[model samples]
Target chain A: MPVIKARVTVTLKNGVLDPQGKAIEHALDGLGFGGIGSVRQGKVFDVEIEGADKAKAEADLNAMCEKLLANTVIENYSVTLI
Target chain B: MKSAVVLLPGLNRDRDMIAALTKISGKAPVTVWQTDTEIPDVDLIAIPGGFSFGDYLRCGAIAARMPVMRAVAEKAAKGVQVVGVCNGFQILVEAGLLPGALMRNTSLKFVCREVKLEIANANTAFTRNYAAGQVIRCPVAHHDGNYFTDPETLARIEGEGQVVFRYAEGTNPNGSINDIAGIINEKGNVLGLMPHPENLIETAHGGNDGRALFESALGLPKAA
Candidate 1:
């Protein structure tokens, strides 16, 4: 079996307030940066599994996102094979 | 009535919760550790505050998946009264035992201070000792306590009187939607709140305003 590498990105859903992102946005503005409309923060997780089947790896990655990587109630998640 | 307190690693307030329960109910609550798969019979289960699992992966997210939480969920399903305070509340929501999510404070800072709480609904098992609209003093100490939910959920909870406690007056510390300080589940057996009622339950704590909550939940006679 070969190792399958994947990346999972988790972010707050639209309409949910992101105070940390907002703070960073303001800091950037204070530092003379321009044209920044808004900012949102998110997390990324790199995972590796011992599997050769891409289909099975994708399914397992999705399950991980649903169960732990992202809280579906307030955040959205996407997975990509690398 | 008998009570039990759930214990999880990094939860600093479990001792406070146990002391409060013991003082109020005249019996020390049985402690259920994070790895425990089963909890003894008890009328009430209290999950205290603190940064469980160091608030990693979102507050209470990791702790919610612990074996003890599975037991807690089972007990809650059986209609046992469950109250999660602060981090405990976060755990409950993360476990899907409650609704909505507690986000970072809009101020982007940790807030620790006394806030006034209005008993929005006094008919539930946890707030029955207080009258509707009665304001009481309680302390709040948390960073990610800004509660947000979908509009439909907000409307439904409000309509069903599930919003049991609201931050009263101008003391909304964390920018919670609807000034919500506490809420109960649809079945009315589970409650999750941000304030630390256990901290203000006795005179030594400067006031006894939070005692009624325990009294009500324990089915004990109200203090005169």
Candidate 2:
């Protein structure tokens, strides 16, 4: 079995309201970081799998994200395989 | 012994929870839908786990603002017991019944499994059946089970003993700090936990650890 490394990152799409990110940005502003423009919060998933094919792993990862990891509507995701 | 279980639109577990509670309480709890304008008399109020509002817009964020939830909040202000599980947990956090928000699991998976929970506080209505520092196994199925809170809030929760069920050591799975699996309000009336106790209430379920949770309210023995 070949071990495939995959990372899935979930981010709030532009025009979506990220309360957590906004809160962080506000805190930074309060800390005198006046130049802070914007921040979008997201989820990062790091998974290592044992498999023979990287392509199969990528497809499976996508399925997982669609069914569970990413909310699809509010969040956009990009998957990377190593 | 009379309890009411609120049913949010898209709430799929309300019936399952009702069965579990009825089996334990000897009476079916009343179900209050999200659009309802009234909350009847009941000793305990439960927000069952489900894809409320199709899990749209940050899990329970939308459902937290439902009309029935407003009523539930009013009841809670009078110290009525409120319990939320999974999506229900998200609702509690969104409703501010409990502190902190559930984020994506560090593993980024919709993990569904049986995991051990360390009962940190045995003094509350929900966990009184278990001994403090005791460990028990239960099931969890969720993607946003990762719990996060500010340092100050974390310290406060620890000092106040509001941290109830913590994940067994080194088994966080979700990257929750302090391995928190559940928490209660400062008053100990509202509880939010990620694990599905309703899934483990029967002897036929291969485990009966969850029976203790519902039984705790009635001061009954562990079903296992």
Per residue, candidate 2 scores C-alpha lDDT tens digits across B117-163 of: 89999999988888989888888888888887767888999999999
The local distance difference test score of model 2 is 0.84
Q: Give me the candidate number with maximum TM-score.
A: 1
Quantify all predictions' global Cα lDDT against the true fold: 0.95, 0.84
Query: How close is every model to the real structure, measured as TM-score?
Result: 0.99, 0.73
Instruction: Give the per-residue lDDT of model 1 (tens digit) for B1-224.
Output: 89999999899999999999999999999999999999999999999999999999899999999999999999999999999999999999999999999999999889999999999999999999999999999999999999999999999999999999999988999999999989999999999999999998888999999999999999998998
In model 1, what is the error at residue B112, expressed in angstroms? 0.6
List pairs with backbone clashes in candidate 2: none
Q: How large is the i-RMS for each model, in angstroms?
A: 0.7, 9.5
**lDDT value, residue A24 of candidate 1:** 94
DockQ of each: 0.82, 0.03
